[model samples]
Target chain A: MPIVDLANPSRFLALTARLMPWLIGATVLAFAVGLVMVKGAPDDYQQGATVKIMFIHVPSAWLAMGIWALMAIATFGTLVWRHPLADVAAKAAAPIGAAFTALCLITGMLWGRPMWGTYWVWDARLTSVLVLFLMYLGVIALWRTVEDPSRAARAAAILTLVGALNLPIIKWSVDWWNTLHQPASVVRLAGPAIHPTILMPLLAMAVAFLLLMVTLHLAAMRNEILRRRVRTLMLMQAQAAPGSAS
Target chain B: MSALAALFVREVRLAVRVGGGGGIGALFFLIVVVLTPFAIGPDLALLARIGPAILWLGALLASLLTLDRLLTADLEDGSLDLILMSDTPLELAVAAKAFAHWITTGLPLVVITPLLGLLLNLDAGASAAVALTLFAGTPALTFIGAIGAALSVTLRRGGLLLAVLVLPLTVPVLIFGVAASNAAIVGPVPFGTPFTILCALTLASLVVGTFAAAAALRQGME
Candidate 1:
C-alpha cells in the first residue's frame, strides 16, 4: 500500500493489528537470545558483575534518546505536513519514551553505586540525561493537560522540536565536559571498544528494545485512535439528546 | 510609533497597571532570598559562598510567577484575537510582548538583586557579578517562558503546568548564569568563558523562543 494510504486512521489501525503479533514475537525472541548472550558474556576485569547492567542500561539510554529523535521527526510531520498520525505518533511515543528514560536513570544509578561509588553526581552526562528525562515529563504533561488533541499536538510538536536542541548537547556533553560518566564506547569513530563477547549481546539487546518500543508505541497509537472515536461518539450522542445543549 | 514599538509600549503600560503583576515577581524574589537565610541560618560564610546560586534560583522562580499573564491576559480580554488578526507578524509581536515582559517583570528582579544579595551576605562585587549575569540571562528566561505562556494560554489553570514545561528548558541558562557568577566571585576559571556562553544562550533562546512561541500561538488559535 502507498504510504499516504496509512494516513487513514482505520487503515493505520488495521495495519498495526496485523503487525503487532509478529512484532511482539520478534521482540520476545530477540530478548531471549540477547539475554542468553549476556549470560555467556565475560565479566569485566574491573567492573565485574556490575558490567551486566550495561546490557539493559545502555539500550534504555539509547532508546531514551532515540525515541525523542523519533518524536522530533513525527513533530516535523505534525507542524509541516499536518499528517494525521504525526501527532498521534508523537503523543503515543512520549509516556513510553519517558519510561525508558526513567529506566535509564534508575539503572544508571544502580550501576553508579557500585562503579562511581555514589547514587548520583552532578556530572555532565548524568545531568544532561536527567534534563532529557525532565523534558520527557514536560512533553507528557503537556499532552495530558490539553483537552484538544490537535492543538495539544501542535503545541507539543513545537516543544519537542525546541527540546530537540538538547539532543546534540547530550550527545556531545561527555566530550565537552570531563564528567564522571564515561564517553562513547560502542558507537565511536574509533570503532567498538569491547570484544565481540560483549559487543554482540549489547547489539542484540538494543535491537530487542527497539522492537519493543515499536510494538508498545503501535499499541498505544491504536488505543488513542479508539479513544478519540469513543469521545466523538459520546459527544454526538450528547448533542442529539433533548435538553443536552446546555 | 511603528506598530511593533506601539505594541511593545502597550504591553509595558498594561503590565504596570493595578494588579498587573509587575511588582509581584520582584517581591517574590525578595521573599525567596529572605527566606533562604532563615532556613539555612545566618552563616555569613556559607551565604557568601552559595549566594549566587540562591539569587539565580530566586530569579528563575520569580520570572515564572508572572509568565502565565504574558499571553493569557490578552487572550482573556479578546485583545489577543485582534493582535492575531493585525498585520504585525505574530513572531515579531510575540517577541515584543516578551521584551516588554522582561522590562516589567525581569528588570525589577535584576535591579533588586543587589539588595537581596546583601541579605544573603554576598559582597558588593559578588552581587554586582550576579546582577550582571541576570541582566544578560533573564531575557532568555522571559522569551523561553513565552513559549510556555503561549502553549498554556487556552487552559483555565495553566500556571503550574507552564512552570513544569518551561523550567527544564531553562536549565542551561541557570547553569551558565550561576557558573559565570561563581567565576567572578571566586574561580580559577576566567569569568569570560561561562559568561560568554550565558550570553550566547540568551541570544540563541531569543530566536528559538520567539519562533516556537509564535508557532504555538498560531496553532492554539486555530
Candidate 2:
C-alpha cells in the first residue's frame, strides 16, 4: 500500500504491529553489538574509563534534540495538513522526548562530575539543554491542563513551532554570552576528530538509541489512539444511559 | 480613529477602568524588589552588584502577572468573538492589545524601577542603566507573555500556568537585559553590544508574539 494510506488509524496500527518485532530485534542486536564494541574500545588517555559514558550520554543528548525536531514536523502535520494521527504523534513524542532529555541531563551530570570536577556548571550547552527540558515540561503541562485533547494539540503545535524557531536563538545567545562546554568535534568542517576505533562504537550506540526511540514512540502512539477510542466509547455510553442530562 | 487605534484605546480604557492595570504591576515590582533585600541581606555592595538582575527579574514577573488579562478579559465578555469576526486582521488586533497591556502594566514597572532600585542599594548610574534596559526589554516580556496568555485564554486559573509556559522562553531577553545593565555599570565589555541585542529580541518577539498569539486565539476560539 502507498504510504498515505497509513493515515487511517487502523491501517497505521496494522503497520506498526507488523513492524514491531523486527524493530525490536534490530534494536536489541544493535545494542549488543554496540556494547561489545564499547568493551573492546580503548579508553581515552586523559579521561580513561570515564570516556565510556560518552556512548550513553552523547546518544541521549542527540535524541533529546532530535525528538523535538521530530515533533516540530509532526506539529506542521497537525496545523497545516490536518493529518489525523499527527496530533497523536506530537503528543506521544513529548513525554518520551522529555525522558530522553532527562536522561541526557542526568548522564551529563554523571560525566561532568569526573571531567569538570563539579556536578553542574552554567555552561552554554548545559544551560540550553536544561531550558529545553523546561520547554518540554511546559508543553506537556499545556497538554495536560487543557481539558480537550484536540484543543491542547493545536495549542501545543503553536508552542512547538515557536520553540523550534526560538531554540536556535537561545543556543546562539548562550554561546555568545559565555561557554565552557567543549566545541563540536564530530560535525565540524574538519570532520570527525576522534579515532575510528572509538567512533565506530559511538555510531553503533547512536543507531541503537534511534531505534529504541522509534520503537517507544510508535508504541506510545498506538496507546494514545486506543485511549482516545476508549474515551469516545465512554462518552457514547454516557449519552445512551437513561436520564442523562444533555 | 483607525480600527487598530480604536482597539488600542478600548484596551487601555478597559484596563484602566477594570482596576487591575495602572498600579498593580508596579506594586508587584516594588514588593519583589523589596523582598530581595530581606532575602539576601542588606549588604549594599552585593545588592549593587546584582541590582540589574533583580530589576530585570521583577519586571519579567510583573509583566507576566498582568498578561493573563490581555485576551481573557475580552474572551470572557464575548468581545473576542466580535474582534475575531471584525474586518481588521487578527495579528494587528493582538499587537494592539499587547501594546496597550505594556502601556498600562509594563510601562509602570519601567517608570518605577529607578525608585525601586534604591531599595536594592543601586546607585543612580546603576538605576538608570537598569531602567533603560527595562524600557527596552519589558515589551519583549509583555509580548512573550501574550503567547502564553492566548494559549491559556480558555482555561480557568491560567495565570500560574502562563508563568510556567512563558518564563523559559523569556530567558534570552532576561539574559541580555541584565547583561546590558551590568555592562553599562561595570564596563569591561561595551554596553552597546548587549543593549542592541536586547532591542533586537524585543523586535523579534513583537513579530513572533503577534503571529503566534493570533494563531492561538484563532485555534482556541473555535
Candidate 3:
C-alpha cells in the first residue's frame, strides 16, 4: 500500500510519526531564519518599525485563510470520497485555524493602532476577516454540539463547504468596500510590489507558519484516532461486562 | 404538489399560532426596533439616518427567531422522515418549508417595518425603501437559514448554534439590503445597483439554501 493511502488510519499515523520530527525541526529552523530576516529588513520609509508587524500579521492571516481552504478540501473528501481521516483532519484543524485567525486579528489590531490609529475598524477587509473568525467558531461549535461523531462530521463538512463562499468575498472586500485596509500587494498581477527585503522575511514567515500548522494538525489527528480507539474499547468493555445494563 | 402545499399550509398555520411569545417574530422585531431610541437617545436625526439599518437588522434577527422550528418541528413528529421518503425531492420540500416560514414569520416583519419606521422617525420614502429591501432580502434570510435549521435540527439546544452558523452567511444580504436602503435615503450611489445585488443574493440563496438544506436533512436523518 502507498504510504500516504487514505483508507487506513494506522498507516496514516505511521507516516505522520515518521514525518513529525522533521516537520518540527523545519518549523523551528524556519522561525529562526524568519525572525533573523525580519530583524535584518530595513524599516519602511512611511510606516517605520511598525511594518515589521507585517512579518507576523501577514503570515498568520495567510495561515488563517489557508487552513479554512484546507478544511474545505477535506470537506469534499468527507462528503464525496468518504475518506475516514478527512473529518478527523478537519476537526483537528479548526482550533488551530481559529488560533491563527485570532493571532491574525490581534496582530493586525496591534499594527493598526500605530498605523491606522485605531485598534479596530469596520473596514471591509477587517470586517470580513472578523466574520471568517466567527465562522470558524461556528464550525467548531457545530462539531461540539452534535454528539454522534459521524453526524457531526457530516454537518460540519456541509457547513464548511457553504462557508467557503465567503473566502473570495473576504479577499476582495477591501476592493469592494474600498475600506481602510490596503489592497492586495503581494499577489497582484504585477507580482509582489513589496521590496525584496520585506518580501523575503514575509515568505520565510509564511513557510514557517505553514510548517507549524502541519505539525499541529498531524499531532491532533493522531490524538483523534487514538481517542476513537479508546472510545471503541470502552464501549466493548461495557458491553461485555455482566452487570453493564444496570 | 398537494403534499408540498399541505406542508406549506401546515407550517404557516403553526407559525401564525405559535409565532408570538408563543409565536411572534414580528413582535420581536417591534421590540428590537422599539428599543433603539431608548438605547441611542432621542436624537431624531441620528435615528432617521440609522433607521434603515436598524430595521434591516431587526428583520434579519426576527427571521432567525422562528427558523429553529423549520425542520425540528417536523423531525420531532417524524414528519421529516416522511417528507424525505416522499416522491417530492427533498430540495423542493425544503424550499417549500422555507417559503412557508417566510410567509408566516418573515412576511409579518416586512409588513410591520413601515409602522416600526415611524418609531425610528424615518420619512415615508426612507421607510418605503427599507420595507422594499426587506421584502426582497428576507426570503434569502429564510432560505439561508433553512440550511442552518436542517443542520442543527437534531441537537437539543441548536438555536444559538443555528444563529452562529447562519448569521455570518447572511452578511452579504445584510450589507446589500442596508446599502440599497441607505442609497435611497442618503446617497450619491443609486438605489438600483445595491437593490439589484440584494435581489441577486435572494435568488442565489434560494437555490443554494434549498440544495444545502436538503443535503443536511438527508445527512441528519442518518
Candidate 4:
C-alpha cells in the first residue's frame, strides 16, 4: 500500500490494531531480558549496587530526549506537508515523553543522593534536563488550551520547532556556565567508557524503553483518531436533528 | 514601510496606555527587587553576590507579565485580523509588534535595573554591568516571548500559560545575561566572552522568534 493510505484514520487504526499485540509482547520480553541482565551484572567498583539504577535512569533519559526528537520530526510533517497523522503522533507522544523525563529526573535524584551526597544539585546536566521536563509540560499545556484540533496541531508544531532549535542552545549554555555532572561517558567519540558487563544491560534496557515508548505512542494515536471519529459522528447527528441549523 | 512604522508606533502607544503593559512591569520589577533584600536579610556581601541574578530574574518576570497583552489585545480588538488581511507580510508585522513591546515594556525594565541594583547592594560597576546586560538582553526576552504571546492569544487568562511556555526557552538569555554581569563584577574570566554570546542570542532570537510567532499567528487565525 502507498504510504499516503496510512494518513487515513481508518487505515492507520487497522494498522495499529494488528501491530499492537506484537509490539506489546516485544516490549515485555525486552524488559524481562533487560532486568535479568541488569541483575546479573556485577556491582560497580565505585558506585556498588546503586550502579544498577543506571539501567533505568540512562534509558529513561535517552527516551526523554528521543521522544522530543520524534515530536520535532513530526512537527515538520504537520507544518510543512500538513500530514494528517503527524499531529496525532506529536500530541500522543507528549505526556508519555513528560513521564519519561520525570522518571529520568526522579531516578537521577535517587542516584544522586547516594553518589553525589545530595538529593539535588544545580549541575549542568541536571538543570538542562529539568528545563526539558518543563518544556514538555508547556507543550502539553499548549495542546490542551487550543480547542480546535487542526489549529492546535499547527500551533504546537511551530512551538516544537522553535523548541528543537533552542534545545542545543540550552545544552550549550548550561555546559558553558558550569560543570558538575560528569561529561558524556557512553556514546562518546572515544567509544564507551563503561565495561561490557554494564554496557549490555544498559543497551538492553534502552531497547526495552524504546519499545515501550513506541507501544504507548501507537495506542495514544489510535485513541486520538477514534476520538476525532466520534466527534465527527456527533456533529453529523446534531446537524441532522430537527430544527438544528447546519 | 509606513504601515509597519505606524503599527509599531500604535503598539508602543497602546502598551504604555494599557493596564497590562509598561507600568505594571516596571512596578513588578521594583517589588521583586525591593522584596529580595528583606527576604535574604541585610547581609551586604550576600546581597552583592546574588544581586545580578536577582536583577536578571526580576527583568525576566516583569517582561513575562506584560507579554500576554502583546498580541491578545490586537486579537481581541479585531486588529489582528485586519493586520492579517493587509498587504505587508505577517513576519514583519510580528517583528514590529515585538520591537514595540521591547521598547515599551522591556526597555523600561532595563532603565530601572540600575536603581533596583542599588537596593540589592551591588556596587556602581556591578549595577552598570547588570543594566548593560539587560539592555542588550531583554529584547531577546520580548521577541522570544512574542511567540508565546501569539500562541496563547486566543485563550482566556493566558498570562500564566504564556509564562510557562516562554520562560524555559529564555534560559539561554538568562544564563548569559547573568553570566556576563557576574563576569564584569567578580570573575577571573573575561566579560567579553559571555557578553558577545548574549548579543548573539538576542540577534538570533530576533529572527527566530519573529518567524515562529508569525507562523503561530497565522495558524491561530485559521
Candidate 5:
C-alpha cells in the first residue's frame, strides 16, 4: 500500500495538534523577518519601490504551483488508495490554493502597472496563472455542489489531478511564446545564479508561504470534520423524530 | 440502435423546441461585447486591440448558460435512466449529447461570431481566427460541461454550481482561443503557437472529459 491506512481519526488529530503551533510560529516569524528585509532592500536601479511587490508576488506564485502539486498528491492518494483522509485533504487545500492564486494575481497586477504601464495585460504567464486561478475556483465549486460527499470527493479529486496539466503551461508560457511578463528568474533552465541579497529573502518568503499553507490546511481539515459531524448529528436527530422519513 | 440515436436526437430536439429565444446565450454574448467599449472606453483602437479576447470570453460565458440544462432535465424526467440501460454505452450517449449540445449552443455562436466580430470592429483576419478557434474550442466546452453537468446532474438548483465547476476546467481553451485570435490581432507574435495549443487542449479535453463524464453518468445510473 502506497498509503498506510490513515483513517484512524485520533492519529490525524494528534498529528495536526503537533504540527499546527509550529507551523503558526514559523509562518508568523518568517513573515516578520521577510517583510523587514524586503522593506529594507535598496531600491532596484531599474524599477525602484514598485519592484518590492515582487517579494509578495513571487512567493505566492511559488506556493500556487506548490499547493496544486500537493493537491495532486492528495488526489492520487484518494483515487488509488481510496484513503478517506486524502479526499478531505484535497478538498481542504483548494480554497487555500485559490487564495494564493488570487494573491498572485493581485500582486502581479500591482507589479505590472508600474512596469508595463498597464494594470492588466494578457501576457501568456499572466493569462496562464489566471486560468489556474479559475481552475481552483471550479474544483472548489464542484466539491460543494454535490450532495453525496464520497462522489463529489472522487470527482473533484479527478479534476485536481487533471488540472495539473496547466502547471508546465504556466511555467513555460513566457518562453513558449512572446509575452510581456518576463521569463523565470531565480528559477530558469540555467538554475539559480541570482544575487544573494534578493535570493535569501525570496527563500525566507517561500518558507513563510509553506508554513502558512500547512496551518490553513489543518484548520480546513478540522472544519471538514466538524461539518461532517454536524451533518451526521442532524441525520440522527431527524431519524429520532417519530414521523421522520429516512 | 437507431432508437438510442433517436433518444439523443429527441433530447436535442426538445432543447430546440423549447426555444425561449436561444437569446439568453446570444444576448449574454452580445451584452459582454457591448459592455467592453463602455467599460474599456470608446477607443475603437483599444476595443479593436482587445476585441478577440472579448469575443472569446463572451463565447465561453454563453456556452456555460446551456450547461446547467445539459443533464439536469434528463435526470429529472428519468430519461437518463433509460439511456443508461440502453445498448449504447454511456460514453457514446455522452458523446451524442455533447454533439447535440454543440449543435444547439456552440454552433450558433460559431455562426454568429463573424457578425459579432463586425460589431466589435474586428478585422477580417481576426474574425477568421475567432471563427476557427470557436469551431475548435466549443466541442471541448460541450465535453467539459458534460462532466460538470453529470456531477451536478443529481442536484436540484445546480446551475450556479455548474458555472463554478466548469468555468475553471474550461480556462485553457478560453486562454488559447483568445490568444490565437489575439496573436493575429495584436502583434508580431506568430499565430501558429497559440492555434496549435488551442487544438491540443481541445483534443485532450475531448478524450479525457468524454471518459470522465461517461463514468459520472454510469455512477449516476447506479
Candidate 6:
C-alpha cells in the first residue's frame, strides 16, 4: 500500500532523485555524439560552411514550435483534468521555449546575413519567426511579472494556445504568399534534398536537442515544485506563528 | 438585446468618465503617424505609399493600449461578478462591450485619420482608403484583443502581456487592411479580397474568442 501510494510528493521526490543521474547521463551521451556530427558535416555545395548553422537552426525551430504545442496540451490538460503539475509544467516551459526560440533566431540571422547579404528581411518566414520570438518573450515576461502564480499560469496558458494557432499560419504564410523564404527543402514531398552525408548529422542533432529539452524541462519542473513548497511552508509559518502548530 | 445594450451603455459611460480611452488611443495613433515621417524621411510619395499601412499599424498599437482596460476595471471593482451572474449569455455582453469599445477607441481613429493623413501627405483617395481600412480593421482588433483582455483580467500587469499575446493573431487583419488600401491606389487587384478577409477575421474572433473569454470569466467568478 505504501509503495503504491507514490502519488505523494515525498515518494515522488525520492523516486525522481534516484532517476536524475540516469537522465543526466543519457543527455550527456546524446549531446556529445550530436556535437561531433554537427562539427564534422561537409560544407554545403551552395551555402558552404554557413550551412552548419542548419544543425542548430532546424532543431531549435522544431523545438520552438514543439514546446508551444506541448505547452498548449499541458494547458488544455490543466483546464480539463485539473492536473496539479500541468500548470507548473506550462509556467516552467516559457523560458526554455524562449531560449530555443532565441537560438533559432540568432542562428537564422547568422545564416541569413551570409546568404541573403542582410541581417533582417521582411520575408514571410523570417517575419513569422520574429513573431514567434516576440510571443516567447511575452510569455516569459508575463509569467515573471504576475504576483499570483496560478493567475500567471492561466494567463500564460492562454497566450501559449493563441500563439500555437499562429504557428501553422506562419509556416504556411510563405507558401501561401510565395515570398522570399523557400518552401520546405528538407521536409519536402520528394523527401530530403540533402545527401545522407549531411542528413544523418542533422537528424542526430535534432534527437540531441529533444533530449536536452527534456532535461531542462525536468529541471525546471523540479525548481517550480521546490518554489511552490517553500511558498506553502512560508504561508503555514505565517499562520502558525499566531496559533499552535497543530 | 436590450440587456446587452444596457451593459454597453454602462461600459461606455464608465469609459468616458474614466478619462476617455478611445480619444487617448486616437491621440497615440496621431502621434505615431506624425512622428514616423521625420524618422522614415519626408518624401510625400514614400509617405503616400506606406500611409495606409502606417495608419492601420498605428491603430493596432493604439487599440492595444486600451485593450487591457476592457476587463481590468470590471475585475477590480467586482462588477465582473454581476456580469457573470446575469441571465444573458456572457458572449453577447462581450460583443456589446466590444462594440462600445470600438466606438470609443476605433471610431476616433477613423475620424481623425484624415487629419493625420495630411501630416503624412496622403492624398484624398488614400486617406479615404486609410479611414475605411482602419474602420474595418480596428473592430477585429477589439474583438481579438478582448479575448486577451478577458484572459488577463485578473492580472495586475496584463497590458504588455495582452499586446504580446494579441498582436501576432492580428497580422492577418493588418495585412489585408493595408492591402485593401494599397489596392485602392494601385489597381492591380480589387479591394474585395482583403476587405472580405478582414470581415472574416472579425467574425472568427467574435465567434471563438468571445465564447472562450466568457467561459473563462465564468470560471473565475465561480
DockQ of each: 0.62, 0.85, 0.68, 0.94, 0.34, 0.48
Write model 4 residue lDDT over B29-71, tens digit each, in one string. 9999889878889898899999999999999999998888788
DockQ of 3: 0.68
Model 4, which residues run further than 4 Å from truth?
Answer: B17-20
Task: Judging by lDDT, tell me the better candidate of 2 and 5.
Answer: 2
Clashing residue pairs, candidate 6? Answer: none
Q: Candidate 1 residues A1-246, lDDT tens each?
A: 998889999999999999999999999999999999999999999999889999999999899989999999999889888876988899999999999999999998998898878999777777778889989999999999999888889989988998998557444533344465566678888889988898999999999999999999999999989988998999899989998765
- Residue ranges of candidate 2 with Cα displaced over 4 Å: A244-246
Better-scoring candidate (DockQ), 1 or 3: 3
Pairs of colliding residues, candidate 5: none
TM-score of each: 0.97, 0.98, 0.96, 0.97, 0.81, 0.90
Q: For residues B29-113, could you state the per-residue lDDT of candidate 2 as single tens digits?
A: 8889889988999999998898898888888888888888788768888999999999999999999999999999988888898
lDDT of each: 0.90, 0.91, 0.87, 0.91, 0.78, 0.79
lDDT of 3 by residue, B67-166 (tens): 8878777888888889999999888888988998888788888888889999999999999999999999999999999999999988889989999999
Error of 2 at B89 (Å): 0.7
Query: Which stretches of candidate 1 lie above 4 Å from their native place?
Result: A170-178, A244-246
How much is B147 displaced in model 6, in angstroms?
2.4
In model 3, the Cα lDDT at residue B193 comes to 89
Q: How far is B134's C-alpha from truth in model 3 (Å)? A: 0.1
> Candidate 3: where is the Cα deviation over 4 Å?
A1-6, A170-175, A244-246, B17-23
Candidate 5 displacement at residue A191 in angstroms: 3.0
TM-score of chain B of 4: 0.96
- Per-residue lDDT value at A110 in model 3: 93
Model 2 steric clash pairs: none
Task: Give each model's clash number.
Answer: 0, 0, 6, 0, 0, 0
What are the per-residue Cα lDDT tens digits for candidate 4 across A1-246?
Answer: 998888888899999999999999999999999999998999999999999999999999999999999999999889998887999999999999999999999999999999999989888988899999999999999999888788889988988999999999999999998898888999898889999999999999999999999999999999988887888898899999999775
lDDT of 1 by residue, B42-109 (tens): 99999999999999999999999989989987988999999999999999999999999999999999
Model 1 score (lDDT): 0.90
